[model samples]
Target chain A: MSKIKVENLTKVFGKQKKRALQLLKEGQTKKDILEKTGCTVGVNQANFTVEEGEIFVIMGLSGSGKSTLVRMLNRLIDPTSGSVFIDSEDISKVNDDQLRQIRRKTISMVFQRFALFPHRTVLENTAYGLEVQGIPKNKREDRAMETLQMVGLKGYEHQLPSQLSGGMQQRVGLARALTNDPDILLMDEAFSALDPLIRKDMQDELIELQSAMQKTIVFITHDLDEALRIGDRIALMKDGVIVQIGTPEEILTDPANEYVERFVEDVDWSKVLQAENVMKRAEMITLDKDGPRVALNRMRETGLSSLFAVDRRNRLQGVLSADAAKQAIDEGKPLADLIERDIVKVRPDTLLNDIMVQMAETNHPVAVVSDDDRVRGVIVRGSVIGALTGKEVKTHD
Target chain B: MTESIPKLPLADVVEVIVSWLQANVGWLFDFISNLIEPTVAFFTAVLMFLPTLVTIVLIAALTWWLSSWRIALFTLIGLMLIANLGYWEESAQTTALVLTATVISIIIGVPIGILCGKNDTARNIITPILDFMQTMPAFVYLVPAVIFFSLGTVPGVIASVVFSMPPTIRLTNLGIRQVPEDLIEASDAFGSTSSQKLFKIQLPLAKTTIMAGINQTIMLALSMVVIASMIGARGLGEAVLTAVQRIEVGTGFEAGLAIVIIAIVLDRLTQNLGQGNGQHPRN
Candidate 1:
């Protein structure tokens, strides 16, 4: 079930009469005036359903409204229009007092700036949301301590926000957002402000936290790589509109438009796209009784240089490269004896990014697919490349 | 022999310093006043050129615009009514006196503010004095003015100036101190001179806070107008005092309402002018 849902949200600023008067007085051109007074359409027709325990990421550049969209989920900023449902209840129209109750108990947010009250110590800042919910001070402190320990900030709870490094401050922000035991956590570029090394550490820390307590998270960032690293599903935003939403592998392999393609263009596909996407289906290829020669020729026809040499029932076959087969045939060796065994393999479920890494490291062009040592199919560099570049692949979903 | 030779008492050294200060006091005050007098005189003259009726209406309209139009309309109506009710001349006199006093206070107070902002020692030394100046009753300041300058507009001006000056100085110092360190560093990196840094960056950043202080100073000066009338300064304060003495309820009420109108107007105009230039002055 979806934990949070947002639909068609919008926000426009400077609607007051004085602002209108000022605009008229300034003698601004219609275009400039319109730009200044225009409706931001902050979350234009935004619609999303985040499942329970999902780490859904909203990725966008600055001013693309990802932060604004996340802020609406917790009612930090009211939407100009649209509805938000948290746990099946519409919270868009909730009054300030009721919203406060919802925020205190149902959803918590960590700001990119780590908006920990500068005057407060780490422990106090973490405990604030709980205190607002009327939790006893001592109990809240204890809970805050537990959260601090969870975020690896156990030794530094007494320090001020200014006293901590950027990473530590963000951990404090994370701890504070989580201390209330809310069902949903909204992180608005929570680690983007930190140093690169520190950002990675915080991402790993968040993964560890989510593994133990799988509250739904809507994290926002401008970094596509970070989104892919952390997100269970990602919503890519452009100009206040959601361009696409899906798993990292889906986005990497099947971008919706040229905009998304431009974003992913410089990405190292060998490290990002997985081998499972390119893995051939065993039933799709015909097995020849003529053995390896026939299979190699069929691979060349299929634009693959290698084939999986299988038995009559299609079980326990090894890879047959055309070059290897030809060399063995010329050397007067039996085709079955010459066929190389112990080829690299991939499960259909392995992420494309992981498979690409393995392929690059091992310099393997073709990987064998098997079901318990029974040959499934041969996945070659060309097939995977086509899949990575968003070409249509004839494969089962 | 060294132990037997006792040091001269500290009082002897203090006495000599006091004598020297007394001799130089007139020269010091003259030189400082000469340095400040032209700026103060310039604004004061410009302010006086504004016709009394226009000043009242302009100030009221400005205050209303910055705060709320509703408040502005009420203030404008109030000022006109106060004039029609025969308190117009007195209200004008009070407006003139308060504006003059506030302007003078800013001139003198801003320099002290700069000093306090630039020097840690000055800030530390002057902070307690500022606290005392802010907290002490406006009436207490009159006691010193009465003893030194005697009674009337001049003495009342002196007393009102002391009461109103602290906020400007304190706020200016605070505003300067609050300027972002990164911005200051960037200025330095660009090879900006001290004066350039002060004028271009620090002062501009502190403008909002300084304006707020000026607003507070004006309000304080307005409040003192009625009290200063007890010593013989004329205006709305005198009208209110006379009405009170003679038990003229209508007169007193009109005069009191006039002060409120004037307060609203002055408050708004300063606020708008300070906040208007398309930059949010960080308070």
Candidate 2:
């Protein structure tokens, strides 16, 4: 089931909220509504869902309402209209006490500024959410210590936040949120304050932690690259409305509008598009069923110098060149002897940029494999050049 | 021909209000005075009971604890000078009065300040009143204090508390209001109740500003010692008043020097205390 479902969530800020809502319903632009009613539209008709264990990113430029939308999920900013369902429960309708309970038990948030209490020690800050839940002091500390270790902050418990570096402080922030073991994590530009190197480290750490913990995370960022790197699905917002929501590849290759296309224009596609995006289905011979004669025939038919030899289950055995196949067929040798196992193999998710270097080192095409060693497709130099130069290569299944 | 502007009956208006309060809420005034009288008496008695040398030693030790030994040495020498001049007892009485007024002011001011900080209506109502309290001449409050408590140390303390409370309340409110918006949001996001946020986040982060407020209140209360003496309150102010009545320049100079000595000691001690609290290492 989807962990969070937000439907038609809208927030209007200022005195004439009802008028603003009316203007919004009347289909006036945010600027027009602001001029007409003197109220700013913070968020407008945002709708999206975060599936279980997915890293769903909400991204936009400053003043695009990405932060406002995230806040509305937890009801930190009460919506003028619409509802947010968490685990099928509409959090927008919960009373203050139930809201508090939900915030304590269901969702925890990390802030842009690493809003750790400057007065509290690292341990105290990390254990803050658990403390709010009234966990016993000893148990809370134990859980907090475990989380701290998970976030790579094992020895700095007694130190104050001021004493830690910016990266360390954010780790403490992450540790604080994780200490509660909540079902969903709402991270609002949590790494935006750190330097680039540190931000990258934190992003990598978050991805690692997400893999291990498998918690549904709704991450907010203004950085497109960060969204592409970490998000399972990304929602691009503009002017208080979500413009498009799709996977990183879909958002890059099939942007819904000119705005989205312009937003992604500067992105380095080679880093985003993977081997699966550029790989083509390869002609292959079954090693158990087909001999060297079949391999040679398939290579000639496909007009390829070499063909992959695979088992009956399509697990890659080796590559067989036409010369080796011909020698094997004349000598009456098994196809295994003719097969070459020295060719490079890569996973389907390997980035095109990474594959570029591997392709440069060898003169042969690279085979893309699934986790169970099944050959899915093969990436040739032409396909890599085609994808990098904006030619659409048929993506692998 | 000249046009005469109508005379404003501000003093008459004040006199009427004072009389009405005295008639209707006189028991409230009595109850407050009754409550504060023993605390004042207790502090005064303790100061009077301690020997001059012992009191000097204790104050010097407090100075040493709060600041450096250099300030403590100055305190020791200064107190000895007052003792030698035969003004030690008056200085003790003044210290007692200032301490009593400062304590009472903080107790009343801090909560009001916190309330003002949290609520817009309370802030709006209290801000103008605070402005009037701070800008009014210190002697004006003594009249109402004398009328309500009627000629004693209690009246002096009440007047001093009235004069000194505005800074504490104003600074406390400002301190809490100045707490970063992100921190408040973080606390709220974590599901902290209002009281928990106040105590844990707002109060702790506002400590330095509140300490500054306390320091200002202490200074203002000390400034009221001479004015408070007019209501028959005993202290070095009384000694100065007596010397002025007799026009004895030498006596006045000696009493005046003792008051100065007492002021320096109290100022240094309180300033050090505030600074000490402000500089508490992160924990």
Top candidate on DockQ is 2
lDDT of 1 by residue, B52-122 (tens): 57865785666665666776787778777876777766766787778778878998999899899989999
Query: Which candidate comes out best when scored by TM-score?
Result: 2
Q: After superposition, how far is residue A232 of candidate 1 from its true place, in Å?
A: 3.0
- Candidate 1: tens digits of C-alpha lDDT, residues A197-268: 989888888998899999999999999889988999999998777899988877876789988888877765
Off by over 4 Å in 1: A16-39, A249-254, A282-341, A349-357, A360-376, A384-396, B1-283
**Candidate 1 - CAPRI tier?**
incorrect
| Candidate 2 clashes between residue pairs 3 or more apart in a chain or in different chains | none
Query: lDDT of all predictions, in order shown?
Result: 0.74, 0.89
lDDT of 2 at B190: 82
TM-score for each candidate, following the candidate numbering: 0.54, 0.95
lDDT of 2 by residue, A1-397 (tens): 8889999899999999998988888889999998988899999998999999999999999999999999998888999899999999999998999999988888989999999999898999998887877889999999999999999899999989999999999999889988888899999999999999999999999999899999999999999999999999999999999999999888988889999999998888798889888989888999899987777777778899998889999999889889889899789888888788888899988999899898888877899999998998999988888888766745444
Clashing pairs in model 1, backbone N/Cα/C closer than 3 A: A273-A352, A274-A352, A274-A353, B59-B265, B63-B268
TM-score of chain A of each: 0.78, 0.93
* Deviation from native of the Cα of residue A284 in model 2, angstroms: 2.4
Report the Cα RMSD per candidate.
23.1, 2.1
